[model samples]
Target: MNTADKPNPAQPHSLSANDMNDKLSGDPISNVLLARWIMRTHFEQFAGSSVADIARAYIGVYSNRPTSWQAVLARNHNMDKSEALRAEDDPELVRIPGMRRSKFLIPKSMANMVFGATCLPLLDHEWRLREAELTLEDYLRIRPELIRFASGSPVRLEEIKSFLGLSGSQARACTTVATYNGVLVRAPSPNPWSNRWLYAAAPSELMHSHDALVDHEQLQWELACHYIEQYGPVSVEDLAWWMGISKKLARLFLEKAGAGEIESGLWLGPLQKKTFESWATNVSESSDERVRFLPNWDPLLMGYSPGSRHRSCLGLDQIGAYDHAGNGLPVVLIGSKAVTTWRVTAKGSQRLLSIHLPDDILQKDQQIIQEAAVMWAERIGAIYIP
Candidate 1:
């Protein structure tokens, strides 16, 4: 990912007293309500939905998790392992290089626009830094070769490297540039259950085609708005960090999107303020105890500013749940707060969910946690061993 120097601080937008009371309350927001809103909105927990629905909702989902597809299917469509594996072959969901240069599964309909919006901006700079000798001419020369090779079938990265007879650095630069240029894409993994993937030409015969080049500024504005809508009460720094752009660019996009600052350093998009107000009302009235077993790299955990929203949910004492790189471990979340780090351990033929809570659980809460764990384990073919 390309990093930029921090820009000057944005002047805080003022909120009226009535606006503050209605949208920005003095009490701390419960992580549960926030989590539910994110899961229901971003993850699309509605029944009878499909993989295309998931892709369309978030533009794309980060597919770095071991069972990323299963997690998406289970959360979004309530699919079990066999069902998710079958759905993986659906032609509408296409994998490509996306935000932060990670693998993402997007709807085939929006692949080109997404590439134009997210990947192109960083490609030239990233490639140049990786291989200073590489140039546009080099990319132009290699484009046809890559398309020809990948046209027959999905090709492995090693195969492309060997066929091109280029050094490792050169191969990486070429592949990245090609992907951003829309000539190629990192194809979906053949096995939905695993993360092993192949490189293939973009606009695969199976993909739904659309050739319009989305306006870069418009896309950036939309991206900023979507982030705020899904992860609002955010800051310019939060949007900048999440989009992997400079803070200056983030501020520009936010302003273009007409996002308002609900409080100092806290921003909300035009549509989100009403949503937040409604959620606040629900939070006050509801006393439901919600538990969820979120997979590693789950967007709910990754979507917000790392130290800001993440810290509030996990608390200072549970800082150990995250690694030095800020990748949050799979967690057992009780009412939006991560109570324990959870993992699946193989025990002979059975996979068992191991819960690692930081503090002792009350007997009643433990029973509730156990039930939710078991339900999640069953969906992924695992047993809860809480």
Candidate 2:
């Protein structure tokens, strides 16, 4: 049976090296190029860079991972330990509840604008759909107590739930509303190595003072252009998923941004001709022997709709790299395709990097892959054991 005839019409065609390279010569194909583009386009800062620079680049790192700061720093080759340490105390960079009520590190200067542009619309839509029993006025009634509890410190969500006598779901909704309205900000996780984030009273003085509002339509247009420029050849569905907006809104934003379709379900912004030409030339000259070990939740994988463009790059088996909860895991990529899963394990005093290849891999390819894994391990300060 032809695999192309599968139910998922977006499934990638299995191509020979030359055929893949031909496609790449005109568009993105390799995850390495995609990952490098993301790093260069969004997070290119010099060593010892200020938190302001970090925030200005791509607004902020999504930071849903444990050791979120470390992950961000690690991806940037220029950042050093001192810079990372200094960034921890930089008042300009503030943590906040953002996209889908998840934690994000945003610039305090643009916090209100970012919230207005992204989170508020989502919150409003969610409220309209659910219409929870707790009202905004009800949340305000207990605001002073909540603020007092979190002032000068961080407080966990559970603590707030207990104090307010709210169920988990209720507390979550209330916090989402509170954060959207600038009543609260996400504090640094007490344990940076864990996913346990805390909430604190919004810095009213700073947040309120900088209510510099941009035209909402203009902001959405700008955002749409940014997404396409960074991850184009993307579809409306991809944009909607990435921006947490509906398909109608995504299409409107793209249209306002002057995006044109490169092909069905793939688009490029108005000024992307030079970029497209450059990438095509680069792809034409590139070697197919490259490999990379990408981290869990890397934007290269997360930037597009998981099963659509992602499946085209890595194939259907890539679904196994995600947990049951839909969280992505670290992966091993040969060219654009994810051929295996990988993880680092602690052994004695050193970290051992293990590569788990798919059973279909030939012995010759396995040897080459093992060698590439060793290189990856060395790059990441791990010991490779094939």
Candidate 3:
């Protein structure tokens, strides 16, 4: 399990629009990622207050705290904005650096699992070590000192700097060392919206110890199962990209977990095939017309890599849903296709939303979009500027 050797990033291997149309033509499941939306409902079902359920389903969602949770729950469960916002304090969920070394809100049960599978291996690479100018011994030795002040309570980076009399770069480097080694974690934001200033705190027993022994294969296999169950009919390339691992490693995890190939280069976990087929049979063309407003970094938008995004972003090639670096943006979805991107900004004490749409959108659809946008704005205490 030595992950020292960085594998070359794989080229996109997912089916293109034409290839998918020709291959699964007229198949209900082939209806441009609509089935994925339906299949996902299978996992999105949970009590309104159960943030852990949502966290477990997506293998941890990007932690913009409750904004990300609220947008996702509003679409899937019709959850109230206040109810979703309360999830920020749900003890069942813990924030950790998960896939891609990004802060993720995950259920406590899987906190260590994700930390082991994704965060621990960070040490095996030399890049961060080189950037920090610290050797393995140096990194480990510095961890305890860096975490001691923030161990029991959340402390801001600035506070750490002032207390330690370290410069900004030195403080960041110290925290980076602590975080990469799993000693420190990004703390909850005081509010739901801004991440401009963040707190750092030591991980609870959920993450246990930085140097604790872990079963890497078991952790990775469990993650592979979760990915397939939640976002499957995915390509190895998609899995690799999502996990920020190489395709060889991704394929090895998939193979070890006995994932099944539904189409060339596309796979589902062995146990997921039957359930996926059942869900696919229930989705109809009418389902394609459903509209949803997904927040920036929603799992659906981040579920697949560049090659497989066509599943949800069909006909959106001209209007990209993600940035140049592949980070997802707030999107307006009609069925599974992204029709536009949306942004929200503070206006006085309220918020203003602007939905960016293509000129070709139909009048009727525009009306629907407006209505949906207004309703979403009301839920968030925002005004939609048409």
Which is the leading candidate under TM-score?
3
- In model 1, what is the error at residue 255, expressed in angstroms? 2.7
For candidate 1, which ten residues in a row score worst on lDDT?
A: 1-10
Candidate 2 vs candidate 3, TM-score winner: 3
CA lDDT, every model vs. true structure: 0.62, 0.60, 0.66
lDDT of 2 by residue, 1-386 (tens): 11111122222332335543644455544544443333334333323455456545445555653334544543444444345545765766777654444556777866655555565543363562255566656666766777777777778999988988877777777766666666777766644334566788887654442244547655555656766766676788988887788999998877877888754566777777467546544543333334455667655556667566544545424437777765567766554456677888777767788988768976765776687666556545568987
Segments of candidate 2 deviating more than 4 angstroms:
1-57, 70-74, 78-89, 120-137, 155-177, 205-216, 282-284, 288-291, 314-319, 323-326, 343-355, 362-386
**Residue 72, model 1: Cα distance from true site in angstroms:** 1.7
Clashing pairs in 3: none
| TM-score of candidate 2 on Cα atoms, chains taken together | 0.69
Query: What's each prediction's TM-score?
Result: 0.76, 0.69, 0.82
Which portions of model 3 miss their true places by more than 4 Å? Answer: 1-29, 32-49, 65-67, 120-142, 197-200, 208-212, 282-285, 309-313, 316-318
Ranked by TM-score from best down, the candidates are 3, 1, 2
